[model samples]
Target: MNNQASRSPVFKAMLETEMEESLSDTIKLSDVSHGALCAFVDFLYTAEAPLDDDMACDLLVLANKYEINHLKNYGENFLISKLNWESSLKNYSFAHQHNAKTLLDDALSLILDTMDNLNEREEYLELVEKDPRLVVNIYEAYYSKTGRCCRCHQS
Candidate 1:
């Protein structure tokens, strides 16, 4: 049996003996990139993983999937610390998809704070085209925070 005492409870649950032999002996993570999978395994063993924006995003997904709250928080914090207006939209979308509450709120705040110029950006247009609901959420957040519609201020 794997030494799972150091792992998160969710991870340890996957080691129950009644699971399939393949699952009991080896966990397959075909959805995660090889690099992210390696980093995840490294974190499992050492409780440390190298983080960058790309790696952080990748690991955040894996952390959430495996219910490793420490890694999830680490990834969210790393992304938040690195966030800028240029990347906030994409990060906001990523955070929303991954359920990273802190990162999501921070990125949404940045987006709303800079909403005056947001629609003029190519990324903003791309977001509108690809995920109109997220754009609507951004507008809703803007109104909730400022007590006025996003359209009220548009030139």
Candidate 2:
């Protein structure tokens, strides 16, 4: 990594802003805000992101904590760019909870296809009930094409 990457004006500005926001709260709670967070943010901004587990973990948590959607999304995409089953749920849930809708949709599709037989009918119905909009959209798609939900697609 270029050592001077940390000296960029843009990266400095963002780090300063984020530290100001996060440190005050962290300090009040006396959580001992490590300078590593700033260093990690600097790395994210300047250098190509480090692909190591330690760097990835730090970025994932920091992105979500700072509400940095782009960084969070970038980290999510990075985790996915090299896929592994063990990390899937962790990354997907983090992305979904932080409002990464497109990623969430992809993750859910994978879950649905791979784990279809794992859930009982009642569980599937409950999921649909919780997100009734999904059902409505499916029904609407069918209705628009042929009128009414097909038995195969209906909740």
Question: Which candidate achieves the best TM-score against the true structure?
Answer: 1
TM-score to native of every candidate shown: 0.87, 0.46
Number of backbone collisions per candidate: 0, 0
lDDT for model 2 comes to 0.50
Residue 103 accuracy (lDDT) in model 2: 55
- Candidate 1 ranges with C-alpha deviation above 4 Å: 21-24, 149-155
Clashing pairs in 1: none
Which pairs in model 2 have colliding backbones? none
> Compared with the true structure, what per-residue lDDT tens digits does model 2 show for residues 1-155?
12332333443344456666234422221332355466454655664455554455556566565455556666667666654444444444545556656555565554444443424445346546665564454345435555445565544
Candidate 2 versus truth, CA RMSD in Å, comes to: 7.4
lDDT of 2 at 76: 64
lDDT by candidate, in order shown: 0.85, 0.50
